[model samples]
Target: MTPKLELRGVAKAFGEKGSPTRVTAVRDLSFTVAAGELVAVVGPSGCGKSTILNMVSGLYGPSEGAVLIDGAEVKGPRSEVGFMLQKDLLLPWRTVIENVEFGLETRKLPKAERRRIARAELRRIRLEEFADSYPYQLSGGMRQRVALARTLAISPELVLLDEPFSALDAQTKLVLQKSFSRTLSESGLSCLLITHDLQEAVIMSDRVVVLSGRPGTVVDTFAVDLPHRDDPLARSTLPATQAYVKRLFDTLHIAEGAA
Candidate 1:
């Protein structure tokens, strides 16, 4: 099967080649996220996780090797990819529905049609009731849901999430995680998530890619054989789930110490 995203011997460095102060953020990192699979990437802080994301998103180019989606090279940000950062970054001036349709509007979608699609997505996020409300009116989790709705409105093939729920309170984070799993499964949309929470990674992903600290590189990958539904109970109590999470914690600990 064709991978949704592929990185082959990718490397990235900052500053000019002759600069002795230059920093290498990632080196010879390679991985493949299969089509329709949700994969999680976890590592210590400043381990170049976001740098990898930036390269894949085309915000930055790889210093070596290549990035590919399916069989073609990812030369730039493809319309088929949607990115959601830690901050929802919704415009406070825009109403809920308006924010959701923001992408469509930028794409020059017709106003009426955009509204139609936006409303559907808002309903999917269970935020239809807040459609006319402004961003400030929604709670943080609700706002993130709105952000996700906006991302999905464009129907991108792959969603790149960078610690999307890290800022939320425990309760809100759990709620959104549940909703996200259902949404991903139902939509069959592929995702590459960068997160620090091992349990979250185990619960939400079909696989987890663990990276080493600075000059980050993929040190290990594990298939999450646990049940895929995003339920807290399954994540905490299921023997298989607990085992995988524990295994990953050990792996991360080893990776961090080695760095």
Candidate 2:
């Protein structure tokens, strides 16, 4: 079967089309995510991780190589793909359900149909009771859950999450991570999570890919072979969990004391 997502000999550069100042952000990078798999990419600051996401999302085309989803080239943003950012990016004027339905508004979907899907998504996230509440009224974690619901409302075949839980408090972050893991598994969704947290990557991903320093390239890859992969708190206490964490830190040359 074709992979859910694939990048072939992918290289990206920035600056003018023919300027000496142009800098290459990524070079000879390639990877693939199978259907229903969650892959995490972890790298240092300014590693061009977001660059890869933008290229895959069709927001920006790579200078060389290709990004293909479901065996088709990603020429532009398509409904089959969903992107969730660090911020909720919910409109305060719009209620929770309204925010969830916002993406479908441009699809020419019927009003009743959009509402039905949005309501179902809210129910899935256990936020049906707050469907009428505005963004400001919900806690940070709740807002993020609504954001996740919004992403799912469109029924994306693949989801790209860029630091989705980085903004929340430690406790809230862990809880939401577990919830997200369970939801994604139950939904059989394919996801690519971009996070800086080594522990989060180990706990949430089926595989973790570490990138080299700036102008990033795939430096190392590790498979997370732990039971109950969705439980963030429980996974943290496991010996294998620390083992993966240690390996990642070692690859990045980050002192264990600093991590």
All candidates: TM-score: 0.97, 0.95
**Which portions of model 2 miss their true places by more than 4 Å?**
254-259
Per-residue lDDT for 1-259 in model 1, tens only? 7788999999999999979989999999999899889999998888899998898888878999999888688888888889999999999998999899888876867799999999999999888999999998889999999999999999999999999999999999988998988888789998999999999888889999999999999999988877745564456677788788888889989988887
Name the Cα RMSD for model 2. Answer: 2.5
- Pairing residues by index, what is the TM-score of model 1? 0.97
Regions of candidate 1 where Cα sits further than 4 Å from its true position: 230-233
lDDT per model, in order? 0.89, 0.90
Q: What is the C-alpha RMSD of each candidate to the true structure, in Å?
A: 1.2, 2.5
Clashing pairs in 1: none
lDDT of 2 by residue, 61-130 (tens): 9999999999999999988999999999999999999999998998888999999999999998899999
